[model samples]
Structure formats: structure tokens, C-alpha cells
Target chain A: MQPDDLSRHLAPILGDRLIAVEPFPETAGRVRFRREGALDLFRAMRDDLGFRHFSTVAGIDWVDHREAVYVLWSDDAKQYVLLSVDLPAGDPRIESASGIWPSANWHEREAWEMVDLNFDHHPDLRHLLMPDGYTFHPLLRSFKLHEPEELEVKARHV
Target chain B: MSEMWINMGPQHPMTHGLWNLRVKLDGEIVVDVDPEIGYLHRGIEKISEDRHYNEVITLMDRCCYVAGFSWEHLYILAAEEALHLAPPERAEYLRVLCDEFQRIGSHLMWYAAFVQDIGLMSPFLYGMRDRDLVLDLYQSYTGARMTYEYMRVGGVRNDLPPGFSAEARQVLDWLSRRFDEYDQLTLGSDIFRKRCDNLGILKANDCVAHGVTGPMLRSAGVKRDLRKDRPYSAYDRVEFDVAVADGADVTARYLVRLEEMRQAVRILRQVLDWLDKNPGPVMAEELPRWLGAPYAPIGREGYLLKRNFPKGVGFSAVEEPHGEAVAYVVNEGGEHPYRVKFRSPVFSNISAARKYLIGYHVADIPPIMGSVDICIGEVDR
Candidate 1:
């Protein structure tokens, strides 16, 4: 499918919430959406577009604003579609996609802990790769490796 | 009996790497499981932000020690895409050679470990002894057996050595025969069947929901191999079958992985023939001055000229031996990646432990987890 095809398909459902559907090499398209419409877009992508296979949910700290990228694959289309949403850095939170895609469970957990993005209503949203009670978000732009800080990790039950 | 949690490891034989599997048991049956990771976490992703693009290939080698070449290929493809650089046709064929060989090597390692878990003593030695041949092939060109940092961003660091194809072909012939012997050792025995058959059956729907890929997902009768579905590298040129089994048990996983090894050999034969016939450039020409240098020379006019390369996000998913490994690289017009997030297949497969491990006997843990092929280096990276 082409970029314009994706935009046309999501137009009715997303309306103004859908941003530019840019063409991405190897993928169907990069669908940019408003953070508020994450849940609705996820459902449409999965149910309507046949992107049943959900891959990765990655969070990036773009300094000014945080970005949440959801990479999904369609078995029928045999192509990947990237859903990107930019959230304000001050309060970066979006509705969790785990309800629609159960595979999002661990990916969301890793994203939450690593980049410190809040996946609202993410069940079992605890530390994944990080130690419990570890106060640093290491993947952020501000977390410099050269700067040495006291590191203490407390053990906690999941 | 009342339920109680059993900690399998920070150090345990069942765990191949550093992680803890907390199992709640009622007598001998597992009622619940909680896996605690991070023991092997070295912040590779965070460190990738600081290092140059070529330097990150070193960490990919360490990602999954058994399938270092596969991970190296995975990262390199994405890095090359983000930089808008296309490797030569010969380089793509060479990558297929590396990937197929790595698949064989990784499955052999899995075969050794899995059989050892099930008390099959002789095959453990057999598996390792055979895997050494593939490692020898890697050491011939890459100079490192376990951690080969041979893949560069634009292309491979080097091409196949002299007479490498002939040597690789011999190993392929031996492995193809050994696969039949493997089936007789495992599937031919009734005890192997009793221990593994119908054990830890995660159905196709459950496997999909849990994001399980690779042999584990294929063994459940879901024939989704990324190489065939989304052909990357020279996979499109080569012909092979997707190994699948319907049992969805420990034995089924074994069968699928063993068949996958055969297919890898088939692919290697074709790739080797092509490599022998065609000889061309490996790395892409017209590369920026400081592509592979550990530290790019920062000149007096560093600030202005660095913006020559346009920013792009490169995402790639390769059917790793463990499962589907995805790497999303953000190149923000610099020597280093802005952000690199990898989706380790074992990470998601292990996350679905509750679905598979629950209600099985405590003794069955080793065989079931063995089938999953836990590579904690990538899991906790």
C-alpha cells in the first residue's frame, strides 16, 4: 500500500487527529497521529488494516518533545507500518496499546522504564530491563555516561 | 499443598544466562511465574547514543553471542538504510552467507543445550563438536569465533577468504547428514518423545498474542518466517522452505529448529555457489570520510559540514534464530545514532512465560525453557 492509500483509509476514522502519512522505504507508510488518538488509531490499524502482528513499541526523547513509535506488521500485506505520535515533553503520557495488542505489554513496560514515558493504564507497568526503585531514566538525552552518580537498586516483587 | 514461590536463578542450570525465574508451585506443579531480568543489562542502547555507528556493531555481537553475525547483519541493514547507502550486490549475497551460516551455528548451540537439559548426554557433545566447524568458518574470515565485529554500516568489513566457499560447502554436507542423525537420536527415541511431546503447548493464537516468533511460533503451525514474508538482504534470490510443525510442544520446537538447520544449509549451498561465481566490491563506494573510524577526526570546521547527511529513521526486523529481532535506529545527521531500540525475540517470548510455564511440572521447566532458547544477552540488553 502507498502513503496516500494509508491516509485515505485512516481519514474517515481519524479525521483531523491523523497527521501526515509520510512514505517510508520498506514499510507501507509512517502514520503520524495525535497522542489523544493513539488508542483509536491502534484499533483501526489492527482490525481494519489487518496489522495483527504487533512488533515493537519504542520511545525516543527528542529533547523538546517525546516520540512514541509503534511498529506493526500485516501478514496479508506483507509490509510493516510505523505509527508515530509526538507527545509534549513536560507530560508525556498516552493511552496504552496493550488492550488492542497484547504483545504491547512488555514493549510498553520497557519503553516506560527506559525513556520514562507514561503509558496510561498499562497493566503491570513496572520495571522491565531496569532494576526496581532505580531512579534514573538512562535513555534520555540528559543522562550522560561520563557523569558518575551514586547507583543503588532495590529489589521488588513484580 | 499450599502455593509457594520458587526462585530458579540468579544462578541456576535452567537459566542459560543471568536472570531469575520466580515460579509459584503447588507441590510439583507450577501455578504462576514471574521472570526478573536485568542482571545481564549493560545499557547497550544508552551507550549506542554516545558511540559511532560502526562501534555499535561491537555491541550487536554481544547481543546474542550464539547468533552474533545475525545481529550484526540486522543492525547493519538498518544503519545502512538510515544513512541512505546501498551496498553492492556482492555484499548482499555475502550477508546471506553470514546469516545462513549463523542460523546453522545457533541451532547447533541450541541443540547442544536443549539435549543436555533433557539428559541426552552424547548428542550434547555431538552438537558442540559439529558447531565448531561453523565457528571455524567464521574465524577464517572474521578472525573471531564468538564475537565477530566484521559487518560495517555500509557493507561487510571484508569478503570471503581464499577457498572459503569450498570449506563452507564441506561443512554444509556434513551438517546435512548430521541432521538426519539428530532426528534418529531425538525423535527416534521413545524417552525423548515422552519427555517432550505435548509438553508446554502454546497454541497459535496464544503465540500470536504473546508476540512469539521464530521456531517457537512456527512449531505452533503458524508459518510466518520473516525471510520469506519480507525478504531482506539476498533472501529474495535464494530459495528455501519455511520449517513448520503442528505439535506446538517441546518436541515440535526441536523438529522445527532441526528442519530450519537443513534449510539454512540449503540456502548456504546456493549462496556459496553464487559467491564462488561472482566476485565484486563488498563495501559501498562514495562513503563519507569517517564511516568506520572509531573517532571521526573533528576538524576546525566541524559544526557546519556535519549537516550534510539528511536525518532518517531506519527500522529492520530479521528472523533471528531465537525469534524476530527488530532494530529501530534514528540517525539524526551525526556520526552516532540518536536512539537505537532493539526488540529482542527472547525478551517477548520469555515475557509470555505465564502462558506456557503455568500448570507444568517443576521438572519440565528445563525442557520447555530450553525450547524457547533463552539468550539473555539480548533479552537484558
Candidate 2:
């Protein structure tokens, strides 16, 4: 499947929420959708497009805005599809994809803790790799590696 | 009976690494499980943002100690794509050689540890003894047994030493014979079958829905291998079967991995023949000075000469010994990658612990997790 195929299939369901379908290497296309239509796009991709395998979800901090990228694989098409949504930096939130793909559960948790991207209505949105009560999101562009004094980690039990 | 939670790890022989497995038990049966990871989390992703593209290869080696070459190949493929550089064809063949050898080494390590978990002492010694030969081959070329920082961004750091293929062929011959001996020691014994068979049975549907992959998925009779389906590197030119078993149990997982190691030997044989017939440059030509120079000091001189390169995103998936490992490289035109994200297969596999662990006996945890082949290094990276 190409970018045109993805746009033709997703345009009707997403309408204006479907921002654009750009060509990405080694995959069908990169589907850029509005954050509001996140669940709808996920359903269409899984049910309609046959992308059963949920590869991963990644959060990229652009400083101005945050981006959540989802990689999916379709066995029938033998191709991968990239789904990306940009959330506001001040309040980066989007509907969780775990409801559609259970595999997205841990990926979402890692993204939330790493980049501070909130997935509303997530089943268990606790700290995954980070220690509990750790306030800082290390993957953020603003989080400097050289600043050791700024780091404060709290013990989970204590 | 009332249920109570017990922590099996953070330090336990079954865990094989640092991480706690909090299991809720009703009598001797496991009612539920909560795996607490992050004990080994080093924030390699955050550090990748500050390092140069070639320097990231160092971390990839440490990603999964058993499967270092596979991770290096994964990162290199994505970085090369992001930088708009194509490695020489010989480099591609050499990489396939490294990957196949790593697969055998990793599986042997798994076999050794797994058999010992099930109370088989002799097989453990045999597994480790055979794995050393594969490590010796790696030391000959890469110069390191565990953390081989041999792979470069554009290509490999160097070529094979003199008569390396002949030495590797001997190891392959020895391993192929040892695989049959392994089956006799394990499959031929009644204790091995009684412990592993029908234990931790996760059906095909649950395996997919829960994101379990690698030998676990293959053992469930799903013939989905990235090497065959996606065909990265020289995998397209190779001829090997995707090992599969329908049992979806611990014994079935053992069968699948043993077969996969045999197939890895088959692939290495072809790759070795090709490398011998075609001798040429390993690294790509005309690379940017900073990236092409292997011994260049990590200082301002290299950074100052950086040209404005076209920005691109490179995504690559490789069938690591553990499972389907992916690396995403986002190059926003600079000396360092803007962002590098990796999807470790074991991360998802371990997250689905509840799906398979529940309904099994507490005594069965060791053998069952052993078959899963949990490598915490990659999972917590």
C-alpha cells in the first residue's frame, strides 16, 4: 500500500482530522492525523487496513510541540505503516491506543514517563522505566544531561 | 486459600538478571504476576541525542550482550539510511555473517542457562563449551567477546582476518554436530520432557495480542520471521526455513530455538562462501570526513567540518536473537542524531508475563521463563 492508498482509505473516516499521508521509506506511508482522531485512525488501521501487529509508540520532543509516532505492521500487505500525531508542548495529551491494540499498553507507559506525553484513560499509566515520584521527564529537550544537581529521585517505598 | 504476593527477583536465579517478578500465589499455583523492570535502565536513548552517530554503536553493543552484533547492525542500518549512505555490497554480506554467528552464540547461551534451570547440569556445561568456539570466532575479528564495537555507521570497522572463513567453517561443523547431541541429552531424557512439555502454554492468539514474539511466537506455529518477511541485509539472498512448532509450550520453544540455530549455521555457510568468492571494500566510499574517519578524535575539529546534510528519518527492523528489534533514527541535519528510539522485543515479551505466567505452578516458573529467554540488558535499555 502507498500513500495514495492510505489517504483514500483513511480520508473518508477521518475527514479533516486526517492531516496528510506522506511517503516514508520501507513502509506504506506515514499517516499524520489530528490528535482528536487518534482512536478512529487506530481502529481504521487495525480493522480496515489489517495492521494487526503493533510495533511500538515513540515520543519525540520538538521543544515547541511534542510528537507521538506509532509503527504498525500488516501481515496481509507485508508492509509497515507509520502513524504520527503532534500534541501541544504545554499540554501534550492524546487518547491511548491500548484500547485498540493491547500491545500499546507498555509502549504508552514508557512514552508517558520518558517524554511526559499523557495518554488519557490509559489503564495503568504509572512509571515504567523511571523511579516512582520522579518529577522530571528525561527525554525532553529541556532536560540537560550535564546538570546532575537538578536531578532528584525519590524511593518508591520510603 | 488466601492469596499472597511474593517477589521472585531483584536478585533470583530464575530472573537471570536484576528485576523483580511479583507473583500472587494461591497455594502453589500462580494467580497473577507483576514484573517490575527498570533495574538496569541506563537511559541509552537520552544519551544517544548527545553523542555522534558513530559513537552510538558503542551503546548498541551494550544493548544486549548476547546479541550485540544484531543490535549494532540494526542501528547501523537505520543510521546509514538516515544519512543517505549505502554500504558496499561486501559490507552487507559481512554483516549477515556477523548476525548469523551472533544468533548461534545467543541461542547456545540460552540453551546453557535454560537447561541448567531445569536441573540438567551436563547440558549446561556442554552448551557453554560450544558457545566459546563461536565467541572465539568473534574475538578473532571484532576483538571483543561481549561488547564488540566493530560495526561503524557507513560500514564495518574492518574486514575479516586471514583464513578467518576456514576457521569459522570448522566452528560451524562442530556446532551442527553438537545440536543433535543436545536433542539427545534433552529430548531423549524423560525429565526434560516432563518439566517442559505443556508447561506455560500460551496459544497463538494470545501470543499476538499480548505482543509476545521471537521463538515464543514461532513456537505457536506462526511463521512470521522478519528475516524472511522483511529480508534486510543479505537475508534476501539466503535460503533458510523459519523454524516453527505448534505446541506453544516450553518444550516447543526449545525445539524452535534449536532448529533456528541449525538454520543459522546454514545461513553462515552460504555467507562465508560468498565472502570468500567476492573480496572487496567493506566500508562505503565518499563518506563525509567525520563519519568516514574511524580513528578521528572526538573533538571540535570533526564537528566544525560538518556540512548541512538532508534531513531524513530511517526505520529498520532486524530479527535479533531475542526477537524483532527495531531502531528509529531521526536526523535533523547535524553531527548528532536528533532522536534515536529503539523497540526492544524482550520489553514487549516481558510485559505480557501475566498472560503466560498465570495458571502455572510456582515450581514451573524457572523452566517457563528460561524458555522465554529473558535478556534484561535489552529489556531495560
Tell me the tens digit of each residue's lDDT in model 1 across B48-78: 8977777788899998999998899899988
Alpha-carbon DockQ of candidate 1: 0.80
Cα lDDT tens digits for candidate 2, B1-381? 999999999999999988889999999999999999999999999999998888888999888989999999999999989989998888899999999999999999999999999999999999999999999999999899999888887778899999999999999999999999999999999999999999999888888887778999999999889999999989999999999999999999999999999999999999999999999988877887778845533666767777767998999999999888888899999789999999999999989899888999999999998988998999989
Best by DockQ: 2
Task: List each model's interface RMSD.
Answer: 0.9, 0.8
Q: State in Å the error of residue A70, model 2.
A: 0.1
The digit string of per-residue lDDT tens for model 1 on A51-77 reads: 888899999999999999999988788
**Worst lDDT window (10 residues) for model 1 chain B?**
B293-302
lDDT value, residue B111 of candidate 1: 95
- Can you list each candidate's DockQ? 0.80, 0.80
Error of 1 at B131 (Å): 0.3
lDDT of 2: 0.92
